[model samples]
Target: MRLSDISIKNPVFAWMLMFGLMIFGLISFSRMGVSQMPDVDFPTVTVSVSLDGAAPEVMETQVVDPIESSLMTVEGIESIKSSSKTGSASITVEFDLDRNIDLAVQDVQAKISGIQRMLPDDVDPPSISKTNPDDQPILWLALTYDKEDPEFLMRYARDYLKDRFTTVEGVGDIFLGGYTDPVMRVHVRPKDLLRYNISVNDVVDAIRNEHSELPGGYIQTDKKTFNVRTMGEAKTEEEFRNIVISRRAGVTVADPTNMVKIRQVADASMGLDKIERMSRFNGKTALGLGIRKQRGTNAVSVARAVKEQITVIQKTLPPGMNLQVNFDSTKFIEQSVGELNHHLILAVIFTSLVCWMFLGSWSATFNVLLSIPTSLLGAFIGLYFLGYTLNTFTLLGLTLAIGIVVDDAIMVLENIFRYNENGRGRIESAILGAREISFAAMAATAAVIAIFLPVAFMKGIIGKFFMQFGVTISIAVFLSLVESLTITPMRCAGFVHHGERKTKLGKGFEALMENTRIGYDRWLRVSLQHPWKVLIGSLVFVAVSFISIKFLNKEMSPAQDQSIFMARLIMPVGTSLQYTDQQTKKRKRGSCPVRKSNRCMQPWGALVAVFLIPT
Candidate 1:
């Protein structure tokens, strides 16, 4: 059967089909994930190894060189870069964009395992990880306190709050910054060690041996056997200090009739780990918790979840402590998405009003306007199935598609109205009008598709960003074409005016259009009479536009108002972590109002690798 014949004769079936599409579209849209940007897999992997007390040069030769050599043989490797720092080495391998990341990671793991025997015995096992851009921190939280020391706060967060944040849905990792645990630092002077006839190595061995748990052989009895467990770990700093190093029986003039202990040879005291890193907020000694979301998860949702959990976490915090969120990545996403939605609604309303004013009948306007929602709703289904997220680019495409989608519907409806006014029956005019414009409408839609479909085939990050946009617009246009041929004619056959039914509003609009037509006719006649003058005027206009192009400023993308700001501190090489923290504190204090009485953090030896200062 003919397309229009089927739609007009069986209007109920057509309506039912449309209703099904609407239902599916709504369901798909509701179920789709929301994020700040589309999910992109960065093609990079990292291998890091740590060897204590090794110089940078030693790290390069023993750790980085071995790993880089092995990774070079992996398939699809694009490039390799390595960095050797004090006692540590990091090697990053970049692979082809189209390569399977899991397979690449597996290949790296295999390569590392083969070179295990070649690596230094004291070096820790090499770690292989795939780096994702999306894994960057989505939220920065600060836990500031006045009365408590920073070391206490750091331990509190590590012991109590770290696991709490981890339990939140979509939270991948939580990094604690600018805080370190109080580790015992034993200062053994050379005179004390010599007097006791003990070496620093002997003291180290004693401390290491003092803290351990080992399983002993099972004790067998007549009835049952019990497993033997020995716990020798120190529970307090005094207990650790009292650990014995060596016993002397007054056999020599330098040795006394006493056991040389850790407390005698080395003064054991609680102190922070040697500060390697420090974070500060607004000039206050601060501890930061950076929250990252898991891959493929919604960043906005995950960030929201973290914020809500923070509220709960605060209730349990110490009285003087406060947790404040300084940076949230989703604020821009929410604002941009909301603004786009507002513009989308406004466009639909204005476009519908334009259709009504031009058609001079509410029913004819409805016939054309129905295509907008139908096309957009159907496009959501396509987006969901194609794994496209609702991002700024995709929404922009939908907004631009609004004009294109309505064109075919208007064309079909106008043709049907023209035939109906020319003494044709409503049903016959609807079917015949739609049939007459079917090929034209198809060709026009194809032309629009042609303009954007090529973008989908382009390569690299730019291409990936626009691929969803092009596909989104193309799908909406195609759906609109189908809607115009089917639903537009079916509705027009029933609701469109079949005779010259005129109202005051209709008569006024008709008179206005008639005047416009006359004015255009006169202008056309004048142009035809003075073709040379018209040609010169057109040439002048073209020249002006061409000249204006050079003055326009261009940018790849507009800057977004993210409601967050960052401060970066570039310190000199070999600077102590303590010095970095001190500098950071001074800068932080100047940026925000801080309570002087509050020692936001205690001086601890904990070292931070990279710190984030949020304002």
Candidate 2:
């Protein structure tokens, strides 16, 4: 028998196929991991150089110009934008979207290595950064303690807290920002630098050479092949101080005293000099912690894990030091998705009521209701396979398509009812309905899928989030079409009521349909006689379309503003605690940061009160 004939012959098998699709969908969805967004990478990178004391002009001449010139020959480069600031140079390298970002980074490394010797030896190795939404911090925490030196707090944040946070599954990068790591800094004196006549290069070479680590060549003499190695990792301040500088050329052939200790020559340059205190939380001394999540892990899950870990770690903190929660993206996702899910459930119930009222028979209504879950389950299965989510957009798309998805079931049932009312057999009515409207149902499904074609073609950020919604709904509507043609008819074989005298519920619907028909006929008759008026109305609508296009503001994605807020901090070279506290306390209500220093922190910017802070 043909598929439709087989479907008409067996309702149980049809339902089985539907559940099979559902099971497959659930499996696929489980396999797909959660992510902030899909795995589509942009072809862009940022390179930053820390020339701490150099002016913009000096960085431009010494750092930026050489790097840009060397990297100019990279493949697939679309454009280059560079900036030089008070203490650094930043060059943003943009490439074609189709290019591989990893390969581009590799190319940049090669380019830099080729010109390394030509650039200022004082400059640090340029760091490469990839541009991705995933790079955005998933969470920010502020740590504060009572009158403690910032170094101690930073050490706790790093040596104590950092390793634990990094070990959490799904965490990407943990950064200890807004403070120093508390290290002993050996300040090099200017007088010693001049006396030794040490160029910064000499100091750089001496330190690197003395601190060099080497793997040894093993010696084997039969009894045992023992390993041999020499190691060095800055044992003490004195070790760093006593490192030897090269012998100077003797003014006299036999003169023997020109060697210098690295400490003597290095004393001229100001080094990390006892970890300068940096302020976090708006000029109040604090240590800051940031967590970045790994891709493909659910944001909701990762955020919860981070919170739990923080709670566990809080018990270990010293008295007075506390952790302040600053950012949590998962909270927003959970709340928004929960609301969307509630609305979707309501939509499903309302749709089922519509089907039951129109059919006015328990058995017939059951077929249509079954079609709804079969369609929905099938759609989600498709979503799982496609690596999509039960997100706001996808749920909204499914909700919108609900009316369309049921249209097939309605058409099939309408035909079955019509055939049965003519005194046809139940078996004959089922087969006839399937045969009669199958082509029309398929055409309608095709049209719905066509509507989403443009959405799939959308490119860049906005497109990435939306295309899945469109595809999920389109697939669902199509599957419902298949059910309407095959399964609905088979289920109809055992049940289609036929009688001239109408049941009480059917009679009410019949009367309503008559009223709707009469009202629509009235409008149809007037429009048929006045084509010119209809044409003029079309012209007016077309004109309004142009006006809307010109007046509307545009954005790359839908604006999702939240009542949730955040705060940023700035500390001038020497902002005091009492002053910072006063400034935080004096914030004007509902404000944000402004250029004026006298203006207190914004109302949204919490003063980071010491007592209530959470670890």
Candidate 3:
């Protein structure tokens, strides 16, 4: 017996199965992550090494060359690119699409380890990390202080704010920008160094030796042993100044010696570390707290949690300090998903109206509409199990499937309705009608699945991006076939009746469709009579379509009005951070007229600037 026959005979079985699927799908939908785009892991890794004050030429030869040579030995490598800059070198290795990124990273690490001993001794250890979209910050906060204490805001963020934000669920890491730790600065006089006949390295060694606490050997007495530690670290600027660099004898052979201390050759004070970059909000110096979310987590959910945590954190902030959100990356994701949802609902509504118009019976139209939600919701089960997010591509697939998913149900419903019109009982017509068309419905669904299934398994980066789209449509189509053979048939048998009443609008729509059918038939007969002319015309139209392609604008994606845009300023390579800040300030002032205009404004109207200094 066919599945439709079983469903018709045992109505309770069909109803329970339908309800069970819907329940499971709803649960899966609730648990699935939401994002702007599908999560794809690129087969790329980066290795960064830094050596303080190393010249670009030195870094390229000593650091970048060795690392690239090592990474070349890793399997499945597509390309290796290196950038050597003052004091730092970065190497990016891209692997083939078939390569597993985790294994590739391990191989790369092993290769680098093999060459580590050959690299320069002073170079820092190589930092290795895989490329991930989630590494980008999802939220940015601007912290400002009313007082002139530059160190206070950074200390508060490091000691308190960072810990608090990290406690929020799904937060991966917190990064601070435009802030530096306080350190003792030693400004050595070049003339004094020459007079003392001491090199800068001598003073550096003296400070490095004196400003560290070292472990001493344990002191053992008769009855007990004690762990001894040397207290050599300086706690105050004066202590650092008192450090002795060298001692020299006087002019006379037997004269007493002269001691040269750090105070004589250098001035020491507490100040910020090197300022390489800065962030500003509304033209005021501010510290930026960028929050990155963990992988495989919902961006919207994480942002919501961070906002809620921010409310709790506000109470603990100091009186003269303030924190405000400067930029939120999740807002675009939320808005895009919301818009897709709106379009999905409209597609369903319009599709239902079209079905009602053609079927001319509200009861039959209702059976067809029931297939849409069941098929779409059931697709969530596949997506959840496949680790797919509710992103643009998946949601777009569902939206497009709104029209396709109704095909199977419409075929079965129309056939069953024809049987009922032939003086047969509803239940008997449904069973006979569905069994007759079940093979044809399955064939049609198979054709669609065959077309899309290959798309899901396509190779390369483009395939990864569109795999969700293909699989989503295929799942929805498959589920629709299942519903048509089971729930759809069952519902039709119970609800649809022969010669059911129709409204005037439905009657008018049916009349219009009948006229259209007659017109189409007349044209079809004419075309059959002049097959040669019709074929030539079709060829001409196809040719025109191909010719028009060159005139069309092409892009990866259409431009959208996201209510935000960014402008970048690149200065000369030798420009300083202070100069970059000044130039950005001038540009910000020049845009005041646009900011004041009511036509072009955003909710966060202030212009946020980031200053960068070349290495």
Candidate 4:
């Protein structure tokens, strides 16, 4: 039997099929991952090596060159880019889109391992890591304290906060921003070192040699053998300070314990490792905790879980310390998706109203409107099966689909209503009406799909982004065509009333339609009679359109509101922490930096602009 016949006779099957699609679509939506963009495999790996006190030239020649040369032989390598900064070398290896990033990283690690012995003894082993778009921080949290020292904040975050955040689901890693591991600082006065006749190397040797512990070998006995442990590990600043440096031999009647200690020659204290990086929020000393989500996870769900956990964690924080969310990625995605959904709903309502006004029948409008949800709901099934996420691109496709999906249903129902108005029976009119436009509907759907199919299969990054959009629109359109052929006719046969009941709105609509038809016919006759004048006017309109194209500014993509802002302060050369703090506090909008000598005179200006800081 024909599809429409089956749909009308076995309407139960059609209803059940539509219901099944709705159920599966809802389930798929709930299970689908939410992200800012499609999870495209970046296929990039970075190898970084640090050699302290080495110049950029030395790093390039010694560290970066060898790694790049070795990695050039790896499979699927597209390009290799390297940069040599002061005392460090960074090499990024990009692979073809089809390359497995995990295997590529393994190959890099193996290459590094083979070349480790060739590198300098002081240079650290290369750090190999696979980079993904998911590596972008999902959240930026700033932890600030009013009266606590940096050491205290660092210790607290390292000991308590870092581990807790790592345990949160979907969190791949928690990087403590502006954090420094502790180190013992030895401040040696030049005068003191000269007086003691000791050099920096001598002091280093004293600490390194005396502060270590080694196994003292087992002492054997007849009854039992005991393990002997040496106990020279320095556990305190005072202990480190007391380490012996040198002893002077003098021929005199004096006490034998006359060796010079490290503290006597040089001051010893605990401090953070040489300050390489610092974090601040509005000029105030702050620690940022960047939480990154795992690949293929729902960013909205993960961010919500993190926020909820942070609420529970706040009660346990020490007084005067506060944790605030600086940036949340989901806020933007949720807002964009919500706005699109709102527009989608509005489009459906407006489209329904237009259908009612034009068709002048509530049943016809209802039948036309039914296709919107059925087709969109069915698109979710395709997305779920294709491993696509509910991201901005996919949502955009759905938004555009809102305008196209209803056309098929509108065509089918309008034809059916017209046939019924001609005195045909309900079932006969529904079936014949749908059958007449079946080819037209199919052709229209295929033409639209053909236009977007090329975009869906585009090559490179742009293609990856637009693929979901194209696929989503095509799926919705195709399903609407199906619904138009089957469900639309079946519904029309059952629900469409035999005769139109007269109403004031209906009369007004008929009057408007009559006026529109008259104006169109008059315009067509005028155009046919004065063909030369119509051609001239058309040429002028076309010329203006082409001329307008030059004035229109274009960009690759429009900027989306991410619901976050950032500001950067550039300090002058040799600017002291105190001077920087004093200048920063001069601005009414900025907070104070963590420093004691905060009183100084310097004018500073911060241009309010967005800057994407390199990670």
Most accurate candidate by TM-score: 3
Indicate which candidate wins on lDDT: 3
Please provide, for model 3 over 1-615, each residue's C-alpha lDDT reduced to its tens digit, 9 standing for 90 to 100.
Answer: 899999998999998888888899999999998877788878899999999889999999988888888788899999999998888888999999999999999998899889999998888989999977767899888787778577777788888999999999899999886668878899999999889777788788788877899889899999999999898988898988988765333121232266678998999998888766666665556788989988778889999999899888888788877787777779888999999999999998999888877777778888888898899999999999999999988999999999999999999998998889898888999999999999999999999899987888989877887899999999999999999999988998898755643677767777888899999999999999999999999999999999999999987567876555455667777677666666777776655345433221111111234332111
Model 2 per-residue lDDT at 145: 82
Per-residue error for 408 in candidate 2, Å, reads 2.0
| Candidate 3: pairs in clash | none
Clash counts for all predictions:
14, 9, 0, 0
Worst 10 residues of 2 by lDDT: 598-607
Per-residue error for 350 in candidate 3, Å, reads 0.7
Instruction: Return the TM-score for candidate 1, rounded to 2 decimals.
Output: 0.84
lDDT tens per residue, model 4, 95-200: 9977778888889899999988888899987788876676788888888888858888888899999898888988888977668888789898888878867778
Q: Could you tell me the C-alpha RMSD of candidate 4 in Å?
A: 5.9
- What is the per-residue lDDT of model 1 for residues 323-347, given as tens digits with 9 covering 90 to 100? 8886677777777888889999999
Give candidate 4 misplaced runs (Cα > 4 Å).
41-46, 71-81, 92-111, 128-133, 188-199, 202-268, 525-551, 560-565, 572-615
What TM-score does candidate 3 get on C-alpha atoms?
Answer: 0.90
How far off is residue 290 in model 2, in Å? 2.3
Alpha-carbon TM-score of each model against the true structure: 0.84, 0.81, 0.90, 0.82
lDDT of 2 by residue, 1-615 (tens): 456678877778876887786777567656555543555556788889877678889999988999999889999999999999656789999998667899999998898788878888788888887887766777777777876656577667777888988999889888766555445454566788788776666666666666677787798997989888777646777777777766333222233366677777554232333332344454355666788887656667778888999899889889887776655666666777677668768877887777767776667767777777778777877777666655566767777877778888888888888888888888898888778888888888888889885686677556766777678778889889888877788778866564442677678887998899999999999999999999999999999999899889897556776544435445464456456556655542333243342212121112232221111
Ranking by lDDT: 3, 4, 1, 2
